[model samples]
Structure formats: structure tokens, C-alpha cells
Target: MVRRAGHLFAFLVVASTANAQMPPPTVGVIQLEAQAVPRSLVEPGRAMASAEVDIRPRVAGVVTEILYQAGRPVEAGDVLFRIEPSTYEADVRAAEADLAAARAAVKEAEAAVVRSERLLGTGTSQSTLDTARSTLEQARATLQSAEVARDLAQIDLERTSITSPITGIPGFAAVSVGDLVAANQADALATVTQLDPIDVEIWAPSARVLSLIEDISLDRVELAESITATLTLETGRAFEARGSMVATSQSVSETTGSRAARFRFENPRHILLPGMFVRADIVLGTANAILVPQSATEREPDGELTAWVVAEGRAVLRSLQEIGTHAHGWIVTEGVAAGELLAVDGLASLTPGLEVRTVPVELDEYGVVHDLRDAVAAGNVEAE
Candidate 1:
């Protein structure tokens, strides 16, 4: 009888151990729903001046003075440099003196002509009168020439005061005081670039942009109203003001297979500068897409993606491809169908083919938990 009791005790101990090892299979499950998302594409681009001009000399002379401070903004017609005006001024004075002399000579010739006319029938000869008249006409022609020379000299003198052709920021002066510069020199004295209302040049894929344009045309969408763009500077900060597409290339580049697109943006604060590397976020169009919560998605050992779903009262795994993110979730491009009961919480204790007690869960508009079952269901579908 004692031997029988020992065997029975051993059997009880083994049964208790087996019961302790077995874990209860239960997991929370929520119905998966597909959400529509809008998409945007980012393209590389660079900022450039909307208007740039070379500050060149109109008339060559010795640099007498520098009118503007280096690296500062200037208004249109603002004097930037001053060439020596002594030579031009001298030429003007000489022309004026020549004009005065011509006037005096004309007066003397007219008087002689009058005298010859009075003596024509007396001792004075006709040739003398003719000579006087010719001299007066010559004097008048000389005066006309001198007047033209004076006007030209004045023009030259005014050009000596070099002024900015456009309102912009002038760069450093290439030449300083007492430096001789030529009028037709290849090099420029300085450069002026417009800072506000800059342009961003982006080379986007030809096929993609063309397709977007065609889609807009087919849908009768307004190009200006439907499209929008923003700039992200090289420092990785987004610009406050938005930009708009102003112009595009007529043909695609054969080498890069992209077409050049120009966008205009207001830079009233002068934050954006020319030759800056930037990123362009172009909103092509909107489309419907399916999104799953990122928390529910798992990365497998093989670098693939997976998620647990409750199928037929057991844990099941489904493969998924997360293309991007949208509305607090991963946008699944493929795998997993709609209306499946996906396990979102308490997944650590569950494995494939394991029985799970599921509790229904709901998500709010912001992807936060809205409502959950108070008690876990005992049976597959009915609450205990």
C-alpha cells in the first residue's frame, strides 16, 4: 500500500509541473482599417538671384573715389565709384571757349559784309562782300561743331560718376582709388545681386513632372491652385515663406533626364541668398493609400516586415511592406488585407498557432486609443 502511495505522489508532482509550464494564450486584437493619405516628393535644388548685374564702367578713367561701402545694399542710380572728371571737365571748357571765339568771329565777319555791301557801288569790290559772307557761314558751322563737342564732353563727365544700374547689394570693388580701368575691359568692377524675391532652380525628373502635368490636365485641375512647394535650406531649417513655380524648361536634359524648373519665393528678410543648396518639396497630387500603425508592425530576423493577426482564435503572422508614413502609421504598399483582426497589444506572450483571448480595441482620429473591451472574451467571438 505504501509503494502504491509513492507512485501516486510522483504522478501528482509531474502533473503540477506540467500545468505550471503551460501559459495562458490570450492577446488583444483590433480590426485593421485602411486610410487614405496625401503624398509629396522632395527634389534637390539651389537658390539663385532673381536679378543679377555686373557693375561695369561706362567710361574709362582713373578711379578718383569709391562712393559706396563694400558689401552693402544700394539703390538704383546710387553712386558706387567716381572716375577722375578733370580731363572731361577740361574738354568741356575748351569746347565752350571755341564756341565763344566762333561767335566773335561771326560778328566781325557780319560787320565787314555790311561795310562791303555799302561800298559795292563805290570803291568796295563784290569779291570782298562774298568773302565776308562765306566767313560768317564758316563761323556758324564751327559754332555748331563746338556745341556738339560740348554736349559730348558733358556726357563723358557725368559717366565718370559710376552708379548702380539696379537696386541690389554690391560686391567688393575690383579696383580702388588711383587705379586705371579701361571701358571695354573683360573684368567687371563689381557685381550687384537682388536679394529679395529669389529664384530656386530645381531639376526634377522629366517623366514625373510631365506625368503630373498630364494628370492635372485630364482632371481639369488648376495648375496654380493645386500645386504648392516649400524650401528647406542647407541648414535643414524650413523657410517661413512658401514658393511657387514660375517657369520650366522646354525640353528635358539628355544627360540627367530631368527638366529645369524655376520657383520664385519672397525673401523680404534677406534670409535666403544666391547659390545656396536647398531642398524642394513638391506636392504632386493626392491619392488613397492604406496605413497600419507602426507599433503593430515588426521587423523580422531576415530584414522583412511582419505583423501579428488573430486568425480563427489563434495568432497568425502576415508580411507587409511599409513604403512610408502617414497619419501616425506606416503606409503599407502590399501584404495584409482589410477587415483582419490584428493583434496590437500584449503580443509578447503570443506565438503562431497559439490560442488567444482577444479584446476588441478602437482608435481615434489621431491614432490614439479610443475605446477597449472591459473584459477579455472567453470564447472565440462571445464574451464570457
Candidate 2:
């Protein structure tokens, strides 16, 4: 009887040991999906359109007619106002008359010269020929002067029709019908802007930009001549417009260590206007970062990034790499692998070296879902 009892005790001890050695069902694990993402720290600028100008007439004569409504589109050479052309018209008529008179004088002088020459052949005094020659020269000078005056008058007349200098959408008009606009008036007829294509200006840290240029490929397929950028409008909605990095500042700003970069976007609908503030996304490069859901991570007192990994059926602690954030998750630049399993749920009671039984979890087709129960239950999900 004593021998039998001892054997039974040994058998029970062996069974318990075997059960302890077996891992408990896992709580949950979400597989990591590799996604190409960009650094999202964005800076905004009050962007101006490609061209903006106050439509000031070179020659002013305003107060006639307002051709365009404020904030209306205008075409180049479209008449915006009618300056009193009466004065210019009178000047032109006067010049024309002067020209005619000058021509008449030339004809009279030529006739006198002919008569004088006939007299000289008939033995008239040399003084007659000299007088006739002087009259012809005076007529020639007057004719040249008249022609120049007429040209000046015509130019002045043309200026009486105040016309749009450029093709653009017009802004407020300062002057109205019957208001006298002085020559070279500072007050503009209207403001015009080219809105079909606009610019987005962004500022990025100097160091980060330099690193991207060095590490990221210059000949990247998307960056043949420019960098691709996505613009977010003021309403928090992304614009359908795609922009390319067209220019960069020559030097870093001493005050902010930020340099200016410009991207060009096509604003066909005129939805974006000049001076509109917008945020932009600039893709630097693709990084092989350890990305995990936000729930599985926690911060320590020292501000270090921490994660719970299951190793050998026990909870394991790990410090995250120093890379920045990615879309919807954090990027662990180091201390992680591409194919490693990461805890996605049941992290509340996680402890180092804790036993767990893990089942596999998977994302949905849209890559937006995870089934933690599938990872933790009869498929043997549990927590230690």
C-alpha cells in the first residue's frame, strides 16, 4: 500500500508539470501590414496665386462706364471704363488740320519755286530763287512737325478707352461711372488674379529635408522633376488637386531652422483662392518601420516608447525605435521585425513573462479591422 501511494503521487506530479509546461491560449495578435506612408508634420503658408495684380490703367480717365462687376472675370483688352475721349478727339482733329495746312503750304512753296525758276531762266534776279528755296525748306519742316503731332494725338486718343491689361478674375473696382480718374491714379480700376493654377507654399525643417535628399532617392519614380504633395483644405477635406514640389528656398531660415518649399497645384474650379491657408503632405521616403496599433503601446515615465511582445509564451517588454509616426500607428525604426507577431488586444493585464495562449488575428479586406476573439479563444486565446 505504501509503494502504490508513492507511485500515484509521482504520477500526479508529472501530470501537473506537463500541464504547466503547456502555454495558455493567446489573448490576441494582429498581423502587421506594410504600407507606404509619409511624415505628416505639416506647416501651412498663406499662398498667393500664380499672378496677382491691381488693374491700374497706364492712362487714366475714369468715371465713364464700369464694364465689369466686382469679382467678375475679365479678358485682356476688355474695356473696363470710358474716359472722356472728347478732349482726345479734339486734339486728334486739331493735329489732322495742322497736317493738312502744312501740306498746303508745301504745295504753295513748290509752285513759287517753279515760278521763280522760270523767272531765273527769263533773266530774273538771283534773290528770287533764294527766296523760293527758303520757303520750300520751311514748308518741309512744318510738314514733319505736323506728322509727329498727329501720331502723338492718335496715341492719346487710344488711351481714352480704359482697357483691361491682363486676363484674370477681377476684384473690387474703386471708381465708378462719371468719376474722374486722373492720369496714373493710384486707385485701381480692379484687381485681377490668375486662378486656374495656384501655388502651395510649405515650410519643412532644414535637417529633415537634407536627410531626405541624401537618403531618399533623387531619381525616385514619382520625383522625376518634383516631389508629390497632397493638400488639405481649410475644411479638413483633402483636395483632389495633386501638386508637385517646384521650388525650394536657397538657404535655411536662421530664425526657425525651417526652409520654404513651393508646390504647384491645379485649381480648375477656383475653389482655392489667393491667400488661402492650407496644409500639405510631403512624402519623403518609404521606411521599413515596425508599425502596431495604438492600443498595444504604452509610455513609460521616462518618455520612452514601450511595447509588449509575447516571447516563449511569456510577456516581453521592448523599447521602440526612434523613428517618427506613420498613418494610424507609430513607426518603430529598430527593435522589430517584418514578420513578427505583435499584441493587438488584451494589453490591459499584460506583464513580463506572463503565460498566454495566442490565436491568429487578421485584418479585413479593407485593412481596417481585427478580430481579437479569433486570436484568443477556443482557438485557445487566454491571458497571463
Candidate 3:
């Protein structure tokens, strides 16, 4: 055993001789900005516009002219299509003529009735007076029939020129020029939707719903009349808009186990549209938290988050407990102390107790590093 210890000491001496020839380690570093953060789950939502309507013709007619272009904006009562008005106009005129003729007959019958009554009092035949009375009643009935016909014909004429009932942007037209459209056509000529003000519908869990209720009931918070939400588009970045919580579904969805919450957004620019898939980030929870750069943490092969900060020129890897995430970094809960020197730049190539060279960085009003400064400021950091 003594001989084995002697050999081990000899090997250690040989290793120390070889280690003395190693060069000093140096690495580039970026200063980390720390701030309050909250750990939250991301929820997805959809874009919705309120003004969606199906345009249907009340009266059937051949399409004579299409006044509005497909996919254009129109005002309420704007002429969209023109049907053959000749038939309806002729009917209206015919009904008017009948009404006038009926009125003339009524006047003639009334005069005869008056004469018959006077003659009866002066000894005219009873049968002659009875015939005059019957003729007057028939004329009055004829006038009533003509009046009903005129009203019906006028309504038909007005319906021949189809106008938009709501003010909005119209979708593709179902019927083009010369396409014969029938009354009670299920397909719409076009769809008009209001987009200046839009709605976003999001599905939230019951727990979040409870929190929202608490905030509202306590009077410590007011529902945001204008909160920013992003819309996912088929092309380009998600559309950004400020919206207010407008409504909530009366009951939770049985299948989804979630509640539907809707917010209204003003989109005067008219960029938003209905049926767009979106993900909205609501700023919530307590703001104060310890934040660090995501890069400073080294993810283990097993996927555990680990961070290495320089402690007295030695790389000290710490297993940290994290809470929330912001644009610049993460909010850590444990395994770190305020004002500790953290290795932000060379975390990838570090192990515990490894020697390192660090350069402190300067930061502006925002936690962004600028020039060399020793002091680290503690403030609220926001996602850029």
C-alpha cells in the first residue's frame, strides 16, 4: 500500500508539470440586462369582423347591370345590381291606370246612387234604386282591389334595383353580369363586411377566467379599452391592433373546456379581416421578477437549464429555477443572487471552476448594453 501511494504521488507530480504549460482562457461577452418578468402561457386567437352579411334579392329578375365592382367598398343603400325594371314598371303603371279608372267609376256610381235615393223619396221604382245601390258597392270594391295591386307593384319595382343594406367592403360577387338571378336565391350576390373596427376571439382556460374576474371585482384593475393584439396573416408579420374586451361567452364550451373571450379593435386603416388565425399576447401578472438573458443559460443534454457565471475568475455553473420570459432574457427564481457577476457571453464553453476573462458592459435607459459600466441597474425590462 505504501508503494502504491508513492507511485500515485509520482503520477500527480508528472500531471502538474504538464499543466503548467497551458495558456490563459479568454472569451467575448455581452452584458445581460435583468428585470421583472412573469411566467405565462401563450394563447392563440382568431381575427373576427362584425359586418358580415349575405345579400339576397327580394324580387326575382334577370341581371341587367352590375353597378358595383367585386371586392370593393360600398356605402349603405348603394346600388349593387340592376334587374330588368321594364316588367315591374309596366305593372306599376297598369295598376295606376286601373286605380284611376276605378275611381272614375266609383264617382259615376255614387252620383247615380244619390239620384236613385232622391227619386225613390219622390216615388221612383224600388227596383231601380236597388240596382243603383248595388252598382255603387261594386265600384267601391273595385277601387280597393286596384289600391292593393298598386302597392304590390310599387314594392316589386323598388326591389328590381338591389341596394346594399349595410355599409362595408364587399366580397366576390356570386352572380356576374348577365347571370340570371332568381328570387330567394340562397347564394349572395356579394358579402359586405365592416373592417375598420374588428373583433378577436380567444379561448381561455377557467383559471385565467377566474383571474380576470378577480381583477375586475376588486376595482384595482379596469378592463383595457385598448389593448394590443397580434393577428397571424398568411403573408407578412402578424397584424397589430389595439382592442378592448368586448364580451365573453355565456357558457364554457363542453368539448374544449375553455371559454370564449372577444375583444374589439379599431382598425380604421382597414387592414384587418375576418377569419384570420391569430395569437394574442395579453400583458398580465405581477411585473416584478428577476430576468436574465436566455443565452446565459446553458441547456444540458437532458434539457435542464443551467447557467455559468464567473465567481472570482472561476466559472460557476448554477442550476436555476426560472419563472417567465421577456424579449431580452428569462426571469429566474433561484440559484442566483442580485449583483452577482454572471457569464452572459461565454456560457456555451464553460464548466464549473474554469478560469475566464470578463468585460463589464454599459447599458442605456433600457437594459440594452452600450459602453463599459460597472454598475448594474435594477428596473422593469420589456420585450423588444
Query: Cα lDDT for residue 323, model 1?
Result: 48
**lDDT at position 301, candidate 2:** 98
Q: For candidate 2, what is the lDDT?
A: 0.74
Q: Which of candidates 2 and 3 is the stronger one according to lDDT? A: 2
TM-score of 2: 0.70
Ranking 1 against 3 by lDDT, winner? 1
Q: What stretches of model 1 exceed 4 Å from their correct place? A: 1-39, 95-148, 218-222, 284-384
Candidate 3 residue runs with Cα over 4 Å from true position: 1-42, 109-144, 215-240, 283-373, 376-384
RMSD of 1: 8.1
Per-candidate TM equals: 0.62, 0.70, 0.60
> What TM-score quantifies how close candidate 1 is to the native fold?
0.62
User: Which 10-residue window of candidate 1 scores lowest in summed lDDT?
Assistant: 375-384
Candidate ranking (TM-score, best to worst): 2, 1, 3
Clashing pairs in 1: 26-357
Predicted candidate 3 versus true structure: per-residue lDDT over 1-384, tens digit per residue = 999999999999999988986654644344334454543334677878766778888888888888887667798999888898999999999999999999999999999988888888677788989999899999999999999999999999999998898888887778877788888788888788888788889887877677656644654234444444445555757666656677778898888878887878778777767887766666444334467677567678987778777678777878886654656566665777776776654356677788877656533435554423223233232111
Worst 10 residues of 3 by lDDT: 375-384
For model 1, the local distance difference test gives: 0.79
Candidate 3, overall lDDT?
0.72
* Winner on TM-score (2 vs 3): 2
Among these predicted structures, which one has the highest TM-score? Answer: 2
Tens digit of per-residue lDDT, candidate 2, span 60-158: 564666778767777888887777788889999999999999999999999998888888957767898999999999999999999999999998888
lDDT score, residue 203, model 1?
85
